[model samples]
Target chain A: MRKSTIIVLALFAALFLAGISAGEPERVLDQAIRICLSCIGIG
Target chain B: MMERVRRLVQVVFTFLTNGYWAFPFSRNIYQGPLKAICSPGLNCYSCPASTTYCPIGAIQQLMAGLRMSLEMGQLYLGWYVVGSIGVLGGLFGRMVCGWLCPFGMIQELLHRIPGRKFDAIPGLLRYLKFAVLALMVVALPLFAVDEFGAGDPWFCKYLCPAGTLEAGIPMILLQPDLRHTLGWLYVNKIFFLVLFVVWSVFANRPFCRTTCPLGAFYGLFSRVKMVRLSLDEERCTECRACHQVCPMGVRFNENPVDTNCITCLRCQKACPYGAIHLEAGGVRLGARQSRPAQAQSS
Candidate 1:
């Protein structure tokens, strides 16, 4: 169930991020980039 | 069973308000509870997947050494926001953190994980949250800054397990590339999460009991909130069922909604006498039950 919940959360996140990226507010785009970068090995 | 209803209300409300979990919104949207009647718990920052405002973050924003304060007899006057959020929290106690809080739902879910068990934190460690409250929420923000004495969301930055677990983990997981340079912040957050999870196995809700500045903010109001708890001494049989069932360990066999009480309504269900009923916002929800509800010491 925990695994299932994590998977559901992951899907929700991916879908939401895709929607936001599609809409891509110019003001927050740079910030989102920072978030993605932070996700990776980058600082 | 009545427990299912409780779960339903908790899940539905948590989902609607914490859209921040599933959606990305900006902080500029709507001002928090400085506008609406305070819901009973700590929510995340306004910008997260939340459909509503985060009262604690908003209130903290208005505090001295924050952005700027316009004081009216110790009332935060700016945007009339501070008074509004504080009043609401005072009215609700951290019940917002307990019931309506999206983060609270997350923690509750974590605790409910079948294999999970709460580990006890020593009595000495219990004070950690209070130190966090005094230092991160108040002292550091008030006195420490880069020449600006500017507050930098000390709670969100340092103490908020909810933010770290929810917004931080979700975003980081979605953008896996950020995992590369996971720093002390990530480490610290994971540490707290592990500690919180282990602690939940035995320590009740250590985070809610200790480090949540939002919970701290709401607790201030639990005693005096307009929608207060009324105990029928006639109905209470000193069965201690309520105390035994309370996740917060509040001894509410006397009065309900005590300082530690999150108003989870577990006590209301625990009473064998059909004794407990919740009254709030000009409405009542009764969990009519027979027998003393078994307290699951999870």
Candidate 2:
């Protein structure tokens, strides 16, 4: 039980870290979405 | 004669590379009809640097760039793209998966390499693609994020064997500098290509059969749509030859619906009892259909 819990936690942590580390280009997408939404009043 | 002309024109304008010298067939004139083929699948937006736009990639670029001005008036539309996908699917289902998809063409070319052959994904796991289609492709992007998240390139990013083959490898190859700048995206693309190609040796397009978001989209009208596969149960002799030939695991003897079938014409030829037919509305005939010759349709 303890080993499985650790593995799952590690997997999720890795996913989160990977997203963060994907750097600016990946996040630039988020900014673009926000800008587009704002243009239409939702941003 | 007109239909043949349409198809010939479609081929000439849509093809990326050709040995022909007849005035560069893949130009703007091919745009209208070929858009049906191009829009429904995740074909590359940048290739031939297209005269039009790929809604999936365009939507993504919009989302990534934050451009959502969907009002009563606009240039192109999500609903139009959705309708095209549905119309094509209802009319042909996986036929599009087999014959017209740019990505499927690439996978078929790879399958023809030296020694590897084809196989089917097992029935139990085929459900995984639906999950990806529903959750990752639609729900996560269209609903879960922002007031409306941008469209997800679910197939391109996660399940697309073709994207890796076409975009990932070529992009990396062309940019000698980008190869030195190797990152996770490049690695993931390679990983996806290797896994999908390896699976193809055992199962004929496990990705298409199971997890292709585009296949899932077309499957909505697979059986009862304007165009579909016809099963003549009266003629069936319980011969599993159709089953043996089917890469998608549908049974003609059981009189299955056509939506999931790709209309590849293999079963039309495979059924010794003549039980299978590709039909649009009431029309029926099946020889020289191309998808079976290529791995995507069968």
TM-score of every candidate relative to the true structure: 0.66, 0.65
**First chain TM-score in every candidate?**
0.50, 0.50
Off by over 4 Å in 2: A1-43, B1-37, B47-77, B112-118, B143-155, B176-181, B286-298
Residue B165 error, candidate 2, Å: 1.8
Instruction: Give a tens-digit lDDT track for model 2, residues B1-298.
Output: 5335434443544453221123134321122223222244555443322323343443444333233434423223233344445445545566766666655554555555667554655666766767776676555555444545345444445545554554455444444454555666556656777887776665565667777767766666554455556776656667588888776777756756633576666777786655667665576654533333223322
Cα lDDT computed for each candidate against the true fold: 0.53, 0.50
RMSD of each: 11.9, 14.2
Q: Over 4 Å off in model 1, which ranges?
A: A1-43, B20-40, B46-48, B51-53, B60-81, B115-131, B174-181, B201-203, B254-257, B280-298
For model 2, the docking class works out as incorrect
Best by DockQ: 1
Which ten contiguous residues of candidate 1 chain B have the minimum total lDDT? B70-79
- Residue B217 alpha-carbon offset, candidate 1, angstroms: 1.6
Residue B213, model 2: Cα distance from true site in angstroms: 0.6
Give the CA lDDT, 0 to 100, for residue B202 in model 2.
58
Question: Candidate 1, which CAPRI tier?
Answer: incorrect
